[model samples]
Target: MIGTLDKAKLKERYDICIVGSGPSGMTLAAELAYSGLKIAMIESGSFKRSSLAEELKEVQSEKLPIKANSRERVVGGASSTWGGLSALLDPADLAHWPLSFDELLPYLKAAAKYHFPSLETFQNPSGTGWKFKNLADKLFVAVRPPFNFTSLVNIFNRKGVDLYTEATVAKLVSQNGRIKKVLCRSVDGQGFEVSAEIFILACGGIENSRLLLVSGLGNEYDQVGRYFMNHPKGYAGRLHLSKPLPVNNYYLPRVVGGRMVYAGLRLEEELQKEKGLLNACVQFEPDLGIFQKYAFAIWRRMPGFSTKVLTIFLPRTLRARWFADMEPRAENRVILSDKLDRFGSPLPKVVYDLSERDKATLEELFSQLRSGVERLELGKLTGTAADVLKVVKDDASHHLGGTRMGLSPQESVVNTECRVHSSENLYVVGGSVFPSAGCASPTMTMVALSIRLAEHVKSKLASKPRRTFKNQTSRTSSQKILIIGAGNRVRGDVLPVLESLPGFEITGIFARHASSLFGAHRSYDVRTMESLSVENLKGARFLYVSVPRETLAQVLSDLPGASSLEVIIDTPVLPAVKKYAHKFKRIHVAEDSVFLPWLDGLKGREVKEIECSQSVFRYHGMALVKAFGPINYGYRLGNKLYLKAGNTKVKIIEPRDYASGKLKIDGQEPDLTAIIAELIPEERGLLGEIKSTDTIVSKMGELKRVGLRRLLLAASRGEETWSLEEGLNDVRIDWLLHKVWIYLSI
Candidate 1:
């Protein structure tokens, strides 16, 4: 379909000219192309020659990522090489933006349809789980949250949008505050020039801003390249699950027809308070053995001169990368150089920088992570012990706001609607309009805004005197799936249902479609309830739900008239006591479990030694605290403490209790999770001290150092009680190691 020719051919004017073929650009094109808008899309890469090698290179002839992110500079843009995970920008991610979250929710659903196509994905993830079901034994700690984004770009093609790969935009030819024409060309020096009533910028967060700076537009505020963002992802390091796998390590697929297939455990928040900053996300990959076998097979099928067996080596190590986000400082920006590319456009010059704030966030996130690893008993102290943390070689590349949108011209490059402040009709679209860097990925939000902008543009077009009909949003979906549990407008449960309902062949998005009265969070009146009935529970292949509720009697009384269906839920509450407990065909949950994937240090346990006079374990005999009625004594241990939940032998001690033998095993209780919570007190706690299975198997030195440092920092900084028990001991790294090694070796 790429028939246009002539390197310098100039078409006076047309409809729209969209640059870049990534999700933002492609989705925008889809919204406008079918309108019979004479669209001219310019891409820098050719569709026929797209390859993984070329896409991963990080630079094109030394040009950095078209602007900085790892956006695919191919025909389909980043979407061409994306992993296809499509989570909407969480409300938390958009919290700092000028627009209200409610404004974007509806659009997000529409965008979800294009990004995540599987009907199973459209329902609750707990319902349509992993592609492969049998490998779950080894991957014991995977929890796919409610909005685990997946790829579904094929849906865009079906909607009749035009695509141009390997082409690039050279410049925008504007007049009278409007984009009258676009100057574009291919990497091979071929050129194109066209015009449209509306122009969109969806190249990506990084590139969109670069394009603006390169085109020399909207520079009054010097904001064209500021506010750069990306979802900084980090990891807690290698996780070793409690269960045995077929091999040492392997990847598991989600259960057949289930929403949650992949699981990941984050450092509990309580621990993060102690750690400095590290917003981390770790992903598992196909196993090394499986990869090796696949490679050998590929070699057997297409052997090379080198035997090609070594290429089978795959990475199973859990990687930690820093999404401890970076803000776009004016100094950290994309500038234009005097040199132009073969296409006659000035190449973009980018300077990437990390502010102290950026580093601190990561430092804290990782700090808690270190403590967490100890508690989970996942891996040995290898990756994290080092000073500098290593990020995943491969990570989520969805770009975000570069030409950020803001309330005033001084703070942002684009106005609230993505329009260049002073220039009417000269609008910028895509992730580049975000005000703050989000912790979540940005594609779904890009699509959401695109649809909204498209409608605005359509309405503007329809308003013309000659226009015959107005384009209405089409919500007529054809697929159907069953929904369940905790969602809807009432009781403030709107988000989960809203995110899952819009796209599926939705038979209904409810707890039990057979009867909404039972377990219905949005039933306005309780007086209109019905008796619980299992007869209407048939025909559902998938189900979506929220955190499990303890009160089921109310639901049982108002049961609907449908049969059972597959189900997905947002919480980890297991199903033991239930009317349909035996019907656990393939249940899915949102968060990671505590036991499996054993990376959480507390997953197992570690013991620590303290100088406190009150003995934690003199011979594992006397109750230390009870024996010494009152003494100024306390020792530190990891969260995976030797004591069981509520084990009486364990005693907790604080500085205030220096004279009393009293110590709270937990802040006031016990439990592996609880201890970890008290030690780190972060998003997910890291430090865990414990009484052990054998003679105090301890990582003593590490504990003393972390504990000391934590205590000092907390006390000197602002801890209420000047005691060592409340935190990590931050001593010289080597010193900490020496102490632990000496004790353990002895």
Candidate 2:
């Protein structure tokens, strides 16, 4: 079960212990969840970012300006914030790697299935329509809406994997050429030990090296953190087209088959090999003038404006941006710093820069790009080789090569299976194990390798009998709740609340898009929802419906077959679902806005005159005012509202006009948090009145009565008092506000 270190009971030992909760670690865990092995997944950060996680990220950089957003320590790791544009590594880039491209192809397809919406995204469109001799299309597909692994944390625990967040691994204890255990500390500074038969370090590029260097585990010849590399990228020059070329459209990121696909221009593989140049991809941004810029912005804002009409007046010139792979150099490495973090582990001192060959490659690639443009009679590039060299300096934040994998111990930290050469049980994954940084983004490749590692791990441990363990109970013995959708709303808001709250358990998840769940929610019994089964509905006490409004009727139509199940509809009840609504014994419309913490001061206050602007009347504003006190008269029409109750004049302001949870009432403003706070106990009691005999709902009502007391007691004892459901509800409101904006704009 997934829990904070201070909460979940620790097992004495586990079959496998993975350090880190990024795409790599989560992928590996999801793949191995059905292996019947007791696993402990330790994450340095919680589901949310904390001060301790931020403090632990400090490092000494030589040439690279390591931005704060470069890496994330949260549960989902970098995937939490990444744009999700990725591609498989080229065969040439993996020339020196122990694993061949052919060997990795299967895992690559598997990884694509897990991360990408469809495999056709990998079958990139041929750019024969946009003819060019020297340049070929370098396709990069973005995981639209960017999938986060946070939703899978609970799923992992449910599958017998104990996931501990906010547990930072401090040091690895080794004996007889194998890792014995990992000494870890909670964010609250409590120390604990996790001993496992196999230990995998998936802590990204820099931290993986730093951990190895400080622990003295895998650096046999001081090669643990060497060969550090990042993709060097920046603007090369400007290309002035004779006329608008169709090839320019390929340069921009566009939606293709429900995915963001960017067909960047790159030097042909044959040409790159002939010139001995590094792999590079170039993007083109139209260089619009001042007036053109405003016109373009306005055109984007107005949906009815035709892009063809706007494009006629735009500039023919475009800024050429280039990203090139760097050669892995020993001089550009991660070494231990003299200073230590709060945990007493030495900080990482990163010394990295481009070599002379790297600079030459950029210059050559730019020259080739100019030649190709000239050959195609498309454009004229205005820049010298020196200009390209001078501007190609920014880091693409694709960290790679440190703790690189190879067959030799003297040359690398890990072997072909990513096992540490110095220790059999210890292994390293993620971008850190890459022997070379490919031109493409590293996330997809990292996931593929993680899946491959899981395969190897499973094969090695298959013959070993399952280890007996105590406290085999899952995270919670609460009421089972079956989720109906796995869309943005469910994943971003609903799942977090259910996972964090005390009296809920996610029994199963149903969604049409279960194919992409290979990364996180795979541990659950995920299936495409065609029709609700009576057997499945009987297992869950409550069915949470979180689909789009348009499809609400079709989804709820199947729900009437399972009459015993209580339904909680997060979406607004449309006219179509009203027929099926009466069929249910107990139905609850979860009006989340009424429980907004900002209105707590007005909880018992009598309301008189209520005026809502056209913007705020549709969502939360009306419900919020109604929740405050009795409203004698009110009329709402097309976003405008007027109401009378007592004497106070209350006006509901548009959400965008103020900060989060801020409301303007009688010229006074108030801010708030925890939308779930006020809703609880009252909401719980209401449910309890219906099902007093039901043990699960009764226990939840009991918990609600003492939630504040338990929160205070936990705080006094230096325990975690994070109001996660409150925060997630706030996020849900934000998502709703976003939808409102889209609606108004359209």
Best by lDDT: 2
Error of 2 at 8 (Å): 7.8
lDDT by residue (tens digit), candidate 2, 569-608: 6534555666776665445554555543334556567544
Q: Which stretches of candidate 1 lie over 4 Å from their true place?
A: 5-12, 34-38, 50-69, 115-124, 127-167, 186-191, 231-236, 241-260, 263-279, 283-323, 373-382, 385-396, 465-746
lDDT score, candidate 2? 0.67
User: What is the lDDT of every predicted structure here?
Assistant: 0.43, 0.67
TM-score of each: 0.50, 0.73
Question: Can you tell me which runs of candidate 2 are displaced by over 4 Å?
Answer: 126-130, 156-159, 247-249, 288-315, 464-485, 492-569, 572-746
* Model 1: per-residue Cα lDDT over 125-173, one tens digit each: 4422122211111112111222211121221221123345455666777
